[model samples]
Target: MKRRQIYFILVLIACNFTLGYAQNPFEVIEEPLPYSKKASSFTINIIGYNEDFVINEWQKYITDFSGLTYVTAVNKGVVEMESSGVVFPLLNDNKVNLYTRFAPNKTLTGVLLTVWVQKSDGTFFSSESSKKEAERIKDWLFEFQDKIRLLNTRIKYQQRF
Candidate 1:
């Protein structure tokens, strides 16, 4: 390959990597609930760079969230609205985004708990607040688990591997 062509390919790859690292403008950066009890409900919001990208990401986000166990429904909408109900306050009012409402009495906790895909530059972002919320939301989860090493019989029984 020509040197110029090789340089172009390298630049493209770097851009993609950077984009993956950047948060999705249309999506909220969420941390997985610390407890996997199942969420009472959750909303996944994704921002769009344009009409086409908005529709495209909305579709992909739904498809991905649907595979999860506790996602009761995926709410789709544009980012232009003053309030995106669930996603607005959390996403800092990005122009394009998507959100999903989780079911009641459930939790999620683990590595890479919440992954937000931002469109501004196709990057990813996360936060401690999101993790704290996930932990808080666990209280509402039906099958939720307590992190504390309680001595109660039930907790002990459940703790046994």
Candidate 2:
């Protein structure tokens, strides 16, 4: 009876661990091309907002960017944005993929936003090419983060008022 009870407890613990791992939304799959091979990725969590709201805001921001043009929703939480023309000599055309994962809980209430860039061929820019274009990508991401922060602040302030 004692051995049986111990085995049962061990099985329960193992099952719990497996379920927790499976439910993690932020687990980055390295085998995927764009996700693991991205030249750069910016991840952030915006509190007090749902996944749909976060995705909508990102869509609006990307559409409003000077060179970026809204293409179409790849899926429910994934959006694809393309450049209007050749933005970089090395990468004739570039594309941005925005992926959002929402996790709402008592402590944290928001979505995880990941921005990835790829070349026209649907692969990450080479290291040499990325070195040349890093500055531009960094600048754009900085501006994008600032806009998100401002939007979050406004939402929180309005909620209080």
Candidate 3:
């Protein structure tokens, strides 16, 4: 199953550009909708690019931001990154692992990407709080998604005009 996933992942791609102004060559599939507190995973689509382009974008996004992210794993085309100690404005201090998987789009445009939070330590002294922790995770994921969305907008606008 793992090998099969890698096979499917090969089609998703990202750009080879450097950090600073680099944006993933992608378009948002949909906006994030409401999910229950128990919900952890959020699926977003990055369509209209080649296989390797999207994947490259993800790798650069994670690695280039040295202080913000730490690369935990990169297998096949799956990238697992852990957040730094920077606590967000959420109710608690909980560091999170950002897990992302990309599957080739059936339409042959881009990829179906699912990103989620898992296996985390309470940030800023490691205080364990379930309620606050869950909210923190969701908020952090949304913030990350928004960053990508903004970047995609820049990419499209610049490419066109």
Candidate 4:
């Protein structure tokens, strides 16, 4: 009887660990960037460039990166938006929504990137599993900026020639 009880206790402990391990501990809450919708938004300026140019560059970058799709692209007047709302509501006008359907076996993740041309600032929101993923997005943005810089340099070089 003692041996049987010990075996049962071990099985219970194992089951608990398995269930806990199945769920991811890190979760991203849905909320807009800068905390509030009424608050002033931030900007990531590409000096000497207009809204159209920045939008084009971002589209190109998104295309080159696999697993990212343009869920929505709205350019109404001065505001611009790009996102895959099917997966999660990561960015609304004033809230950061959660993506609860994320699975460990899934290979693709969705992202939302918005830009306000008139203000010259943009918002980038996504559900990231780790700090590395956030850093990767930042690095990609830097790469996009580098591409714009190269293009500008070439234009300047050609004008000089």
Candidate 5:
């Protein structure tokens, strides 16, 4: 009787472990959403030239970003982007966007891309899409980066002056 009980207990434990460690379907086969991870607690938004497209269409092009791991859902793609240091905010819009462009490595239009992190937290951090209110999420991403670059240049000029 004791031997049977022990066997049953072991089997139950094994089943429990399997269930707990089962692979997540999203991680296994889904394309990650286009977003950049600068580091812990930081993400950037990416944008493309032809920004508007069906959500499904977006899924087809996730491979453009080599550093990011992407997973696709019914409508949105989740991305696990690679980063080494702290992530800085590039934009202040609410939602993050991923954009693609030409890449030398790959023979695809809009093959290369970049990301920007919007900053519309408004006191509380909410994961809501703010694309509607801000019509040009893609343009904003570039403009935001340009502004950062310009600011850096001005700082350097001032230091030299």
Candidate 6:
């Protein structure tokens, strides 16, 4: 009798689990980005260059290097993105609103960068913030100049292929 009861209990438990799962046939969960958005700006002044080359290399660099590749946006002269890393202590983040500009027919110019802490009437967001990301952004733009130089050499050899 005891053996039969034990077997009965096990079957009941198994049925409970199966039914619970069946009730929710299709359950889906979406995840958020690992890092919080902080704001910063950086520039590289390589004037009189081809627009196509500039945008392409930047897309490759921004999308390829940062862990935020899945969420990063690389549009014409504007990139809205994030980098995954340390969380910041501040309540809110300094959103990295990266935007770019180009001359219609190659106006001569260079690049610049700036960073700041946002004013606090803001709700607490620093908890979700990623540290050193802004610095890394500056570095990304800094590296961009070099990528263009290398690209230029490749283009020279390829003769605009």
Candidate number of the best lDDT: 2
Whose TM-score is greatest here? Answer: 2
- Per-candidate TM vs. native? 0.21, 0.45, 0.41, 0.41, 0.24, 0.37
Question: Worst ten-residue run, lDDT, model 4?
Answer: 97-106
How displaced is residue 70 in candidate 5, in Å? 16
Task: Write down the lDDT of every candidate, Cα atoms only.
Answer: 0.33, 0.53, 0.51, 0.41, 0.34, 0.43
Tell me the lDDT of model 3 at 60.
Answer: 58
Give the runs in model 4 whose Cα sits over 4 Å from its true position: 1-43, 66-77, 83-129
For 7-44, candidate 3 gives per-residue lDDT tens digits of 66664432222432344433322223244333345455
1 versus 6: better TM-score goes to: 6
lDDT of 4 by residue, 15-100 (tens): 99998875542232233345644322222334456555655666565444321334233433243444332221122222221111
The candidate with the higher lDDT, 2 or 5, is 2
**What's the C-alpha lDDT at position 68 in model 5?**
36
Question: Whole-model lDDT for model 6 versus the true structure?
Answer: 0.43
Q: Write the per-residue lDDT of candidate 1 for residues 1-161, one digit (tens) a residue.
A: 69999999999999999988764422333343454323222333322123333334333433443322223334342222111212322345333222333222122211111222232343223233344444333332211112111223455698895
| Model 3 Cα shift for residue 102 (angstroms) | 0.7
Clashes of each: 52, 0, 13, 5, 25, 12
- Full-model lDDT, candidate 4: 0.41
Arrange candidates, best TM-score first. Answer: 2, 3, 4, 6, 5, 1
| Candidate with the larger lDDT of 3 and 6 | 3
